[model samples]
Structures are given as structure tokens and as C-alpha cells.
Target: MTDRTATAPDIVTGAGTDDACCLFQRALGERFKDLPRSVRDLHTVKGESGWQGRARVTRGKSRIGALICRLVGFPEEAEDIPVSVTIERRGDMELWRRDFGGKMFASVLCLRNGEERGHITERFGAMAFDIDLQLADDRLQFPVARGRILGVSLPRALLPVSEAGEFEMDGRFHFDVQVSLPGIGMLVRYQGHLNPVRSDD
Candidate 1:
């Protein structure tokens, strides 16, 4: 069989008014923006097995906390993984709100050529947490829940890249991530894509 995997290109650079609405909608989808209830959808990889399931969100109700997202996928590799994400909105400040949280789940959906790999899920919190950014001498700095931090540095040529394309928007948003699990030791050098959903419906 021929390998049909699509390779992403290096980040591109450009200048365009960074629109929050565009970014949010691109990350979480328009359906999630207006709904205050549970939501679900299918997730697929370009040349790999796809996942189909639903996500339930209990808004500020129940003992779980404020916001909770529960998603279930398919295939033996991802069948047992249930991503549990919690979202909390900070103060009612003007524009940006402080957001921070962790993801607790597991799956082999990120595998490349049968090797189990760590993949970033679309429902991950960091994917949709928006904030105001500043360009320093040559670096980009943004604030998180803990404090001001250094944001991902993309080449000047890859600024306008969206989640739709293979290079810019793949299964995983950040290619460089350091995750340390109890028994799993550490997961490094991870990357993948969350293929774009067709249609606005």
C-alpha cells in the first residue's frame, strides 16, 4: 500500500489583523461558541484512522465543577480514551480573560505507521484559550493563568496559517510539547493534525 500521509510545511509569516472570532471559531467551531450545553463531533486524521463520538458539557452544574467536556473516540487504540477537560473563565475584565487547566486522557490515535504516539486532541483546553499577545524585540509574549509567559514562536512566514491546511493546522497544534505522566515517564517531540471539519453545518 502507498503511504498517503500529508506533510506540513514550516510556519509561514505575514501580517493580518488577528481576529479573535476567527481564531475561536477555527479552534472550537461555531456550534460550540453559542451552545451552553453539551456538544460532540467526529475527529479524523488525513491518512490514519478517524474517530467518531460526542462531547457532553455540564455548564456550572453538578459536582464536577463549572465546565466539563467528555469525548469518546473509536478503534482499539483510541476506544478506551475519554478526554476530560474543564474550563474556567476568570474575571469580567475588558477583553482577555485568564484561563488555565490541564488535560487528563490517553490514546494511540497520534500514531504514525503503527507506532503509538502522543497526540493533542481538538478538545484540549490550550487549543481554544485565547489571550492578548505582545511582540517584544523578537519574541512573542502572552499571559496565562500563572503569569506572563513566552508563547510559541512561529516563523514570520507562517503567521496566517489556519487549522484547515495540513502544514499549519494538523492533528496537533503544538509540535513541541513536554508532558510527564506518572508511569509513562515523559512524552516529548509530539505532533499531529485535527483535520478540518467540512461545511459550516
Candidate 2:
């Protein structure tokens, strides 16, 4: 997404004092404990040296989607590494494209090493759409066969990481998500944790 209005926080933040990674793990456990009914189960598998897992998403109490995520292609001592995620959904096949791949509605942030690396943002006209994003300082512009873009800003907060390695932060992060469906004039907000993954462990 073109971050024309995106503003960096006045002060960037890290994790809690004990151990940033530990804090992250605790927070994720607490958050997932209350996942919506649409989500059946979420778990992380620790391999000999990395992480991988499958998240199951449900629809009307039936398992209908699965997302496989992994921290592959990272060095052993790499405190900050990249992750890859692939989501697959079943039902109303056409909607899946617009929901996950089309321009009008899609995730705006793709991260590498816990930093915003790229995204898919689009502007749509009824059915046709245009898209753009910034990856490693390079901007890739293109269009899609369907769906439209809704421009919005993402709200963020700072977590203070002290020299002693202890940290804590309090605030809600929000994102302005705009999308145009065939019959829906869309404007909405997506609210979630600023950083979902916590530790390299």
C-alpha cells in the first residue's frame, strides 16, 4: 500500500522487561485463548531449530480453511528473521480470490524480520482494480482482474525495551481497511496486536 499518510511513531518500542521474546510468547498464548469460534485451533511446532505450524479456520463451526506458516530460510542465531505464510480457504470459491488475492480486500502488510516489508493495496472500480506496494524500498505497481482498493492508515504504539532487557507497552493498534464489493460500499477497521510473534525460541 502507498503509505502516503502512514506516519512512523514518535518513539519506537520493543518488548517487556523480562525477555521480549518471552513476553511475546505469553501475549500470544493469552490472545489465542480467546480466539473467535471461526478459528478452531492454532499451534506452533518447534522443530530441531525453528518454528512451523498450521492454523485452522472454520466457517459455521466447520473447518474450511488452513494456513501454513513457517520460519524457514533463517540462520540459527538470527534473532530477527523472516516468515512465510500461505492461506487457503474453501467455499464460495469466487470470494476467496477477492478476499485473499484480489485488490479491493487484502492484507496491507507483509513482513520480513518482524518489519513491514511489502503489501498489496488496491483501488477498484466495480470489478477491475489496481494495486501497489513497497518491498525493500522498491515499489511494485500493478492491477488485478477484480476487486477495488480502500485506502486507510494503520495506528501503532511503542513498547519500551530497556538496556536491562525489560519492556512493556499498553495500547491498541488499529488499521483503516477499505474495500469495495459488488454491492457493498466498504469502510471498516481491523484491530489487532502490533506484533504477534514474540520470541526466536
Candidate 3:
């Protein structure tokens, strides 16, 4: 597997202003001081501490939604899954990485006007797919993106409905996300709170 992040130098460049870059880096620095050492030491997500939480995944209600989830290798049902996530600076772009159980996932996020756009790559068994994603405020919005399976583009109609968001509550981060399809509501949804952890813990 290739590290797409390492190959894209231009992807991290082109911030609109030095002020924005400074603010982003400063924010990450404060955030990094709050993470577990193991996660903070990763090459891409380095120098930052983040949150740990538990999330639940509910099965979709509609048959189409269930089918889409299965096609993408999501579990039929899951709950209280432990999660650890971090966001750090890699060159000029932000590197966000999440560890769900032992599965590793990552995205390279570009921030503009308090919003973000990025490429997400997820691995399911032996298959890995690239997804386009955007985030504004606390809401994750997808504007007609495609998934690749075995180097082939999957059908748009079958794409799981994607909904996600994150925010702070009680000084901790919280997030909720759902994937569904037309007529088949909520293939999977996960939500939980994230608390800061120390490197020694």
C-alpha cells in the first residue's frame, strides 16, 4: 500500500495567509499537549494529542442502506467501539488519523474559513477505497463523491448516505456520523465523546 499522504507535497501547501497558518499550528499545539504518547508519536499525526472515546454503530433500517453498508465492508451492527483520533500538521495540511479498535484510518484535511476538505482512504479486509469529503462547522457534508473498489468506480446510487459532525461538550470533543442510502435509511451510525489522555497513560 502506498502512503498517498507522503506523495502529495502540493496538497499541504497553498494556505491563504500566514495568519491562518499560525493560528492552525497554534491550535494544534495546544491540542497535541492533551493526547496519548503512542498516538502523538506517529509520523504523520505527530506532536499532537487528541481524544479517546467509544462509539456505537446501528444497522441501517432500509434494505438498500444495509446492502450499501455490506458492499463497503461495514458491520451489520456494532456498538461501544473504542476510538482514538488525532489531528496534526504535516507540512501545510492537517493530518487526521483515527484508530478504531485496531483498524487504522487517515485523511489529509485542508482548512479554509473554519471548514475542511480532504481525501479519506479506508481499508476493509484487502480492499481500500478513496473517498472525497468536506467539513463545515460541525457538519460533514459530501457533495456527490465516488468510491473505488478494486480500482473500479462504484455506483453513485448505491453509495451509502454519509452524515457526520463533531463539536466540543464539557471541554471534551463529541462526534456523530451515519452512512445511509436512498430508501434504506441509516446503514450505520456512530456517536460518542472524546476525552484527552496523556502519553504516560
Q: Best-fitting candidate, measured by TM-score?
A: 3
How do all models score by TM-score? 0.20, 0.20, 0.53
Q: Could you give me the TM-score of model 2 versus the true structure?
A: 0.20
The TM-score that candidate 1 achieves is 0.20
Report the Cα lDDT for candidate 2. Answer: 0.21
Better of 1 and 3 by lDDT: 3
Count of backbone collisions within predicted model 1? 14
lDDT of 2 by residue, 1-201 (tens): 212112232112333222222212232344433432222111122211121222111111111111101111111112222322222211100111111111112122111123322222222111122222211211112222223224232221211111111111242211112222222222221212222333553
Evaluate all candidate structures by whole-model CA lDDT and list the values in order: 0.22, 0.21, 0.52
**Model 2: lDDT of residue 56:** 19
Give Cα distance to truth, residue 155, candidate 2, Å. Answer: 32
Off by over 4 Å in 1: 1-77, 92-153, 156-201
Best by lDDT: 3
Deviation (Å) of 42 in candidate 2: 20
* RMSD of candidate 3 to true structure, Å: 7.9
